[model samples]
Target: MLNDIVKNLLKEVSGIAEIPANAAFNIRNNSKSEGRHSTENIDIVPKEGGSGLDIYVKPFTKNENVHIPALITQDGVSEVVYNDFHIGEGAEIEIIAGCGIHNCGCDDSVHEGIHRFFLGKNSKVVYIEKHIGEGDGSGKRIINPQTHVEAEENAYIEMDTVQLKGVDSTKRVSSAKLGPGATIVIKEKIMTHGHQTAETSFDVSLDGAGSSAKLISRSVARDFSRQLFRSKIIGNTDCYGHSECDAIIMDNGVVAAEPEIIANHVDASLVHEAAIGKIAGDQLVKLMTLGLTEKEAEAQIINGFLK
Candidate 1:
């Protein structure tokens, strides 16, 4: 049933084009099946080599939701890879990827995914990723994703991410070099409730002159949850880079944000900024005086802070 749903979703996105050929593709499940609602129940493995897969992925036409639960374990070293070729000038692509998990049982899950783009000169791409989990399941999940983007001169790439409510999640990320006169923008928003913990990090660099990079991040934590975000932008030669982080805290919640910007050349320019705070009590009180209940006022304050 999950496979059918994914295939239908992919078909809706594929539109009139023929399904890309799948070659040298494999899937393995070795762990005991966790309770229902596992992501491992549904998996789509892309072939090693593919053609006609260079087209852009537009944003979802409307709101979409995907929920699943699964337990996957790897005894020895294992890996998963995806490779694609995209060659187009003055093109644009927007993708929205999201997932929700209710339980993972006891088995640990590891996901290592890669995306490669052969962008043409003056092209633009925007990618958004979201992850959410629920319940009191006690299992570990690790996600390591690498994106290699070859942006030609005057090209642009924008990446955004949002992670909400997880028990124990760790994400490791990587990115490639940007071409001359290219620009890269990154924005992230994360929220955690309950006793969950999450750690995520990203590393990006501008390898060509006249390139520019920017990162903006916001995190909110409640209950006993802990969240950490580490981001770095490096400017080489005559490039420019800037990064900023903002966080909100509540009910013994803890959050740490680290933004690092480095300039390796005399002509390079870099900047880093970060802020951490809690919802203003006076603001909440003022709202409560306006006929709103305490719960409503607190929710409004948090919504405003995240915005």
Candidate 2:
């Protein structure tokens, strides 16, 4: 059974309002395991070092979903967890993960999560993660996340990451190495406001022939907030890579985008795009002409852009 706070945090992060009785899941709260379940084709086992869990997906498994979410409810608590995923050959799965923090005391609450994925040949996986913070206290909410991926030949992986709201400070990093014929796609969205700061870094190495990678990020900064985005793609063989960053700034906010691409082979191809600006006047005017207020129009535009 989950308490009200844990339930709410679970819902906000992973959209799991009620725990599924027949699905694979591991819910961690304040560095402790709240609940766990394992399916026939998927297994979730705690690590021997007491750090995190090792999730295994059997070969040829399909249409399976796994949820691993963490929450921090008490103030002045800090923890680091390491979770690893072993994806078997020919398996296709979806993993849902996120973290939420609720602090009401005069001390900072922090959680750092490290995730690594090892993909077998011809496997495919989609991973989604979201972060949020909530409270009325004077303390800060801090979260740092790191992800590493190793994809074998013909494997494919897609990562979707979002920072929803109320995070005071965050630094996110992700890196990947791809084998022959492998591919990876990453999409990230973030919103920062009220003196908050957010930073994101991504590095991908196309180590084999026919490997490809694409990275796209969109962000909104408002009310004195600051954001920075850095992306690097290195092609060691004949491969393709692309990176893009688009941002909107408002009300004294600041945003920076740095992109780097390196082609070590003659057949390697790479491209990068970055754009940072405020909301367009014509967009606001069109929405206002349709019976919307200025604030409402701005909110709608931001929502659409992030989506």
Candidate 3:
């Protein structure tokens, strides 16, 4: 049975209103597995001698999704977990994973998660993750996530990561290496306010011929919050790579974006773009002419920007 708080947290982070009877899932609460289920094509096995899970997707499988969500409801608790995903050859699947924290005490709560993905030849994967925090206490809510991806020949992987709001601090790190004809795309969105801090870093290597990678990030920092975005792309063969970072800063907030690209072969191509600015006055004026207040217009703009 799912408690109300856990259900709400799961919905907030993973968009799962209730546990699905026909789907594969592993629900983790307060560093322990609360519920787990597996399907014929997908197996969720506990990692031996470890506090994590090993998820395997059978070869040639398609149209499946696995949910792995973590929730923290107690204060002064901290945990670090490792999860690995093995996508077999020619499989097409989606993975939804996230973390939510609700701490109502003076002590801080933290969750550090490290996830690795291994994509076999010709496999395709869509990965989505979201992070959120909620509470009325002085305790801080912190989450740190690290992702490592290895894509085999002709594999494809798309990742969408978001940090919605209320987190006091976070550091997100991701790295990927692509094989021949493989491709990887990553999209990230984040919002931080009220003295919060967030940092993101990405490193991608296109090491095989005809491989490509794209990384794009959008973020908003408000009310004295601080944000940092850093990305590096390396093209070691005949490949293409691009990285872009865009951010909005407001009300004494600070944002910094750093990007680097390297090309080791003559046919390698790489590019990067970064922009940091506040909301445009013209946009606010246009929205306000529709009878919306300044605050409403700002909120609308920020919502759209993060979307």
Model 3, 1-307: lDDT tens per residue? 8899889999999999898788999999887788899999999998865478999999999999999998999899898889999999999999999999998899999999999999999999999999999988799999999999999999999999999788999999999999999999999999999999999999999998999999999999999999999999999999999899999999999999989999899999998999999999999999999999999999999988877
By lDDT, highest first, what's the ranking? Answer: 2, 3, 1
Global local distance difference test of model 3: 0.94
User: lDDT, candidate 3, residue 129?
Assistant: 93
Tens digits of per-residue lDDT, candidate 1, 1-307, equal 2243333332332221222333111122222211112112112323434211122322221221122112123323224445353535665554433333334355544545466766677777676655544434465544455566778887787877666555355464646578889988878777777776767676777888899888787878888888887888887789888888888888999998876777788988998888888877788789988999988998887676556
- Which ten contiguous residues of candidate 2 have the minimum total lDDT? 1-10
Query: Using alpha carbons, what is the TM-score of model 1?
Result: 0.71
| Stretches of model 1 off by over 4 angstroms after superposition | 1-45, 48-87, 104-106, 135-144
Instruction: State every prediction's TM-score relative to the real structure.
Output: 0.71, 0.98, 0.98
Ten-residue region with minimum lDDT total, candidate 3: 46-55
Q: What does the lDDT read for residue 156 in candidate 1?
A: 86
Model 3 quality (TM-score): 0.98
Order of the predicted models by TM-score, top scorer first: 2, 3, 1
Instruction: Report how far residue 98 has shifted in candidate 1, in Å.
Output: 3.4
Q: Least accurate stretch of 10 residues (summed lDDT) in model 1?
A: 33-42
lDDT for predicted candidate 2 compared with the true structure: 0.95
Comparing 1 with 3 on TM-score, the higher-scoring candidate is 3
lDDT of each: 0.58, 0.95, 0.94
